[model samples]
Target: MTSRLKRTLLALSLAISLPAGAANYSIGTGSQSGTYYPLGGMLAKVWSDNIENFNMRAEVTAASVENIIKVSSGQQLVGIAMGDSVASAIQGQAPFRKPLDVAVLFALYPNVVQFIVPADSSINTIADLKGKKISVGAPGSGTRVGSTAILEALGIHQGDFKAQSLNYTATTNALANGQIDAGVIIGSAGVGAITELALTRDIRILSFSQAELAKVHAALPAYSGMEIPAETYSKVTAFTAPAVWNVLVVKKDLDPALATQMLETAFGNMDKISKVIADAKNATVDNMDKLQGVPLHASSQAFLTKMKGQ
Candidate 1:
């Protein structure tokens, strides 16, 4: 072969052997009906659009608990998990027997606990859920974890009510159809399922008094207080509820540079994200430090340090 031809062939061989770019990644999000699904789609779109050769997508799952398990087990590169679920997984608790090998990216927004009851139901308080049919979110969702904890915090046990394991859409359907007297939902303030139910069925969002809030705090310290605005649902005035932070998380072993890149890309375009999901507006660098229990990923920590110095 001629010297020029030989050199050209060698260059082609090397180029073929090199990777195209970062590996394609999947983010585990909640059911198609939940906020996480849409938000995850926007995040995936942003990353894929801005970064060269970035092949990323969002996979809908059971949310929180399942997302955490998937991310910790390397089944997913990242996911949206409730702060409380992250704490439990790290502490080797019920949902997770061992600590999850995951780290935080940032806090997304508050997962406000909404207890929706039919307008004519006699049930009025958290305690009144006893002996009633209630939907406490799907089994593997973070909503389920929070619902269970909040019930327990109020001294209500699993045996207290006829609990149905249904997703947000199912919960709303059941509530509206009178299949369930009450349904507990932990989601954004304007979750669609609840809103749709309100338009047809007179709905009431149960609230907690100061004393009830104290009891909840004693059991789950990660939760703080939040209120649902008066007009959020039909016939439901503003009321106090338990709130937990929703955080973005990734596998602990993710490449540091890649992890940092992911964080920067997501937060740098927060405005775009918020347009898709209103709750994402709360995702800020300042809120990143507010995450509890779960430690920040090494690269995430480094990125924050660099951000602070600027």
Candidate 2:
């Protein structure tokens, strides 16, 4: 081949072999059986497809607390976390040695605190959980943080109950096998684990009384009253529960332009994301107000403002 022809061939080969300006990132998600994992996967796919040279992956993590620490410490690019945990981290709470610098990308959905028990069990109220074997979710998980806070608000300290930290799948299995009296699952309605558990065995979701809810709200102001609608799970009736919004977060210092691009890619593809996770339909510019405590990432705030004006 002529020298000019050879040079042209080499250029073509380089173009095919190297991805110019490629950017790789991972989204820290929760357990495989939980909502965060699937939702994170969907977001990664959509963002990857829409953003030029952007490759994103979903990583299974210990959920909220771990996600926050990882993202804030620059170990991960982004993560999904509970609003309460984000607030706690900002305030330098336990599990967080000191305040973390993080910013909200957007609100995902409300993670309702589901206190699940066997349908026939007599444990109808939060007060009845005293001294019972309970699964308070996995270590460093949002479920654990919310459960511990709710229980403490009700005057049920650590010693008042037998606490077991287990993942959603293990919690369901243990409950099914009569190993634990109840399990605390904090996720969007129709969480996969709870749905699967309800398929084989009848289960009841205990509700918080008005008085109990007041105490909980007083303690954890980030939480608000929410009702898990009737039949959200098989044979489980609607019940009042405390819920906190789940949010996508990124490091505070992420590039404003890149952050805006990420938000645009995700928001523009909401239809696709909602098809995969029904709760994702709630992730809209209007619902940005649902995010509590943490400030919105500058790019996200600008994006929302732009979306609103349009």
Candidate 3:
């Protein structure tokens, strides 16, 4: 065969073997016990089921910090991250060594800073946590960063507490088995582990006083004040806490059209997601601006603008 003909045949063979216009994507979400994984799974289902020639999968990761690293490195096509972490990733702040290029898709929900203790435990305030066994959060998780920052801001250094780095499920199990005195979980108001723990054992959700919250704002201005209603948990009444927006982000180089399509698909079926995870109901186009730090993906910004005009 002629050299040019052989080359043409090889190219044709390759094209024939590949699925035409097929795209495969992976979404990095938190551990299985957290809301991000389930919600991401739902989105993956939507994308796979609805978008022709598109295949997506949800990966259970170490949560926000890991998700950010994966998506920024292009190991994952998409990820859910805390607003502060997104900012931190871009600025090459603590927990991130070098600056990462990522773009925001939309703000999904608020990750409330939940300081939980046994209902009967005497740890009433952040100050009461001194010298106590506390699960700051798992290593490489955004919760860890926030927990450290908040504690340091309140003048409670790492040495002040018997710090245990555990994930949401592990934290819940540790607290319930009497292995830990307190745990900090930054997630949707009624995170799964907390709700499950409250079902069998009384749990106390600690609220930050206004002064404490002000200090949090100073330490991480990305966090905003949030309130968890009395009915959200079993034994806890209303509580005031700090929260940061949880945003969907993509690789900075992702195709704008695909980003916009993914946004529309996820938000369009949000009602389905909310039925399973109530926190997901908070996802809406109007709240897109809640995403700060990283700039919105160009396509997402254009989509939001188009939504606003309608």
lDDT winner, 1 or 3 = 3
Colliding residue pairs in candidate 1: none
How well does model 3 score by local distance difference test? 0.89
Q: Taking the tens digit of each residue's C-alpha lDDT, what string does model 2 give over 185-222?
A: 99989999999999999999999988988898999998
Model 2 superposed RMSD (Cα): 5.3
Q: Residue 32, candidate 2: how far off, in angstroms?
A: 1.0
Worst ten in a row by lDDT for model 1: 14-23
Task: State candidate 1's TM-score.
Answer: 0.91
Q: Backbone clashes per model, in order?
A: 0, 0, 0
TM-score of each: 0.91, 0.93, 0.91
lDDT of model 1, residue 221 = 90
Query: What overall lDDT goes with each candidate model?
Result: 0.87, 0.92, 0.89
Tens digit of lDDT per residue, candidate 1, span 59-138? 98999999999898888888998989998888879889898778897788888999989878899988899999999999
Predicted candidate 3 versus true structure: per-residue lDDT over 40-155, tens digit per residue: 99889988887778988999888888999999888898998888888999899888999898889888899999999998999999899999999988988989999889899889
Q: Give the least accurate 10-residue stretch of model 2, judged by summed lDDT.
A: 14-23
Show pairs that collide, candidate 3: none
